[model samples]
Target: MKIRCIAIDDEPWALTLIEKYVKQLPQLELVATFEDAIAGSEFLRKYPVDLLFLDINMPDMNGITLASSLINKPFIVFTTAYKKFAYEGFELEAIDYLLKPFDLDRFQKAVDKVEKAMLAAKLSQKSNDASIFVWSEHQQVKVILSEIMFIESRKDYTCFHLYNKPKLLTLLPLKKTEELLPSQEFVRVHRSYIVPVKEIRKIASRKVVLQSGEELPIGRLYADNVSALVKL
Candidate 1:
């Protein structure tokens, strides 16, 4: 499994050490490193990572405080020189707490725990019923797997096109909504559109024709993602 990660520390040397250790493990992909806790927190807000290696004491905002405030929380491993903060880390449900000057072996153990937790979470999601619920027309509307034809992002909201129902205009981001659907059933062919794999009727050089005769342009960057649509 590929684990995307980021290391945040006030100390330059600490960040370097963790970066080196992360690189030693081929499974870990270091997205970015930060010396400022506030900047690191902002990065997490925009981009989601599988794991985070955080230092406790820092200027502006502390590690524990920053971790708690994150809306999309990643599996965090606290790295700090102070042992007194271990209990606080536990309260935040951190995967592991590593003391300063720890070796690569200790880092490996923490990463191992992250991998196992991620696997278990994936399995749990797969075993559950596959469906997406959205608030539309002032009510929570449950959309089944087969009812959806396609999804379009409209600035601040997402529009769900259905077979026999009116299009659902809900307050949702395309990226977040994509995460809620089964990957095999949905294909995101553009930044603004996600088509149900089964609904695709034909694919051209730059666009796709749906079974309902809807044509959506394929994004330049996301073109490769729609190759599976060709087979179906």
Candidate 2:
């Protein structure tokens, strides 16, 4: 994974060192460097990056203050000569703290932590995408995508049929319900019915036979798409 990063330091030599170190790593993509903290903050507002190499001591603005003001904060790695700011940096949940005049080995260790954190974040997002939350019975309920067998329209409400569980009824129109489901996993076979693609056993005589042995009629408008599943 290419990690887009930027460095902000008032010292030109520090920025040069950061750029040189970033270029040595194949996974690191240094997008931009800033010598002014205020200009760096403005750039961050317009374009969010994955990582930030920030200097704590700047004449214009304090690095910690700028980090706190950001609405979408990136993973921060604070670089400074002073050790007093280490506690404050950790309080902001900085990935790592690098002392100034540090060698390449220390910088590589900080980047390793960032990579692990990014990988964990991606895995968590994938897990969240495999489920959905809906208001049911006056409380939000999590519906696992894999457990869904079919969906049936009931006027202004929709009923979810799941595997080995009681049916769930939610106050949503069929069109709204369809928008929440993944298209590749579920299909609208009729005006009143939506079935999981994997649960479909066969299609015959304009009827879809599910793996559970229940059959649903295919609507005239949706017959072409429903029949196409047989070709798969």
Q: Which candidate is the best by lDDT?
A: 2
Tens-digit lDDT track for model 1 on 77-112? 999999999999989999999999899999999999
Clashing residue pairs in candidate 1 are none
Deviation of model 1 at 59, angstroms: 1.1
TM-score of candidate 1 relative to the true fold: 0.56
Q: lDDT at 134 for candidate 1?
A: 81
Error of 2 at 169 (Å): 12
Per-candidate clashes, comma-separated: 0, 0
* lDDT on C-alpha atoms for all candidate structures: 0.90, 0.91
List per-candidate RMSD values in Å: 15.9, 14.0
TM-score of each: 0.56, 0.59
